[model samples]
Target: MRRFWYLPLWLTLLVTGCAGQAERGDSLYAQLGGEAGVDRIVAGLLWEIAEDSDTRALFVDTDIERFRNKLAEQLCAVADGPCVYSGDSMRETHRHLQVTSAQFNRLVSSLIRVMEQEQIPVGPQNALLQRLAVMHGDIVAD
Candidate 1:
């Protein structure tokens, strides 16, 4: 069986309103280790995916550098950091991938592992994942 390192704090959203989200962005960004910390986590996650055979095929034809930059941007943006995401929407990006639920779950596991490696605290990690959870429908080929 695949070892799944899932979240115990998933969906614990930090903000309840748009104003709150805007206010919490900086705090969340700082909690996520700021730009440098975010960079490290994104890099680690990309590395994790690259090393995992189950998820590696998803990026076989992808540009690692671009993926890294865009993911960093997206994560930063989601955490209410100063970065703007210049990549395509999640649905558009994954439209052709036919990504399975298992693939999506594996990627999330990789992300959790990366966050753990970064020594990120549970609250910020859950907040970040909760924010990104909105994109799940678009990312997964349902």
Candidate 2:
């Protein structure tokens, strides 16, 4: 079982719309520790998924390095960083995978673990997750 560290803080920030943060341009990206920090978070997430039995098989035939780069780009863009994701749309990319809710939740758990490990403050982490969560319907198949 995974521990939901700082979940309340995440919820609070979401409910609050992260007020006062928007006044500063690109603060979310900066608060996310910028390019280096996002890279580390993505790398750590990949490592965690690679090591976990439940998730490892999902990436077996994948080009992990490329996936990492794309993921980092996607996350960076979502966080209002300098990078942009030129990869396929979430729906198009995962259409053939038939991904389940359980798998998606596990991936989210892995992501949260990376954010926690990197000590990315709860607000920024939740903000990013909220943005990413919109893609859930696209990525998960019926």
Candidate 3:
């Protein structure tokens, strides 16, 4: 009888502890400083991309404000935030661009620079990059 009682108690404690750890872990979105933080990071990244001679041409005819908003939405969604990215799929958006691996790498480097400038800790910055890097297949075709 005592063994049975202890079993349930142990299970309950285990579950409770796991739930608390989950809550404490939080989402990457929160770690990235939420929506405002995302905006700041994205803005800095776009600025870097525009100034990077190797990647500037990609945004030559783009509407920067709209791009910023969409990029933020996408980043927020990927970070498990509340935003919904309504932009076209990555493949569809980049299909005609014929983006090369070098170009893609340049953009990623710019993004990393912005993250560093934002003073985002290494863990969260790497986490965000990991999430974004999965889209390389869709964004890089050349």
Off by over 4 Å in 3: 1-22
Expressed as tens digits, the lDDT of each residue in 3-72 for candidate 3 is 5878988999999997996889778999889998999998898889868888888777778888888999
Residue-wise lDDT of candidate 2 within 80-100, one digit each (tens)?
888778999999888878888
TM-score of 3: 0.82
Worst-scoring 10-residue span by lDDT in model 1: 6-15
Give the per-residue lDDT of model 1 (tens digit) for 1-142.
Answer: 2354334223334334546766755588899999999999988998889898989999989989999999999998998889999999999999999888999999998999889988998888899989998999998886
Flag the better candidate by TM-score, 2 or 3.
3
What TM-scores do the predictions have? 0.81, 0.81, 0.82
Highest lDDT model number: 3
Cα distance off (Å), candidate 1, residue 17: 23
lDDT value for model 1: 0.87
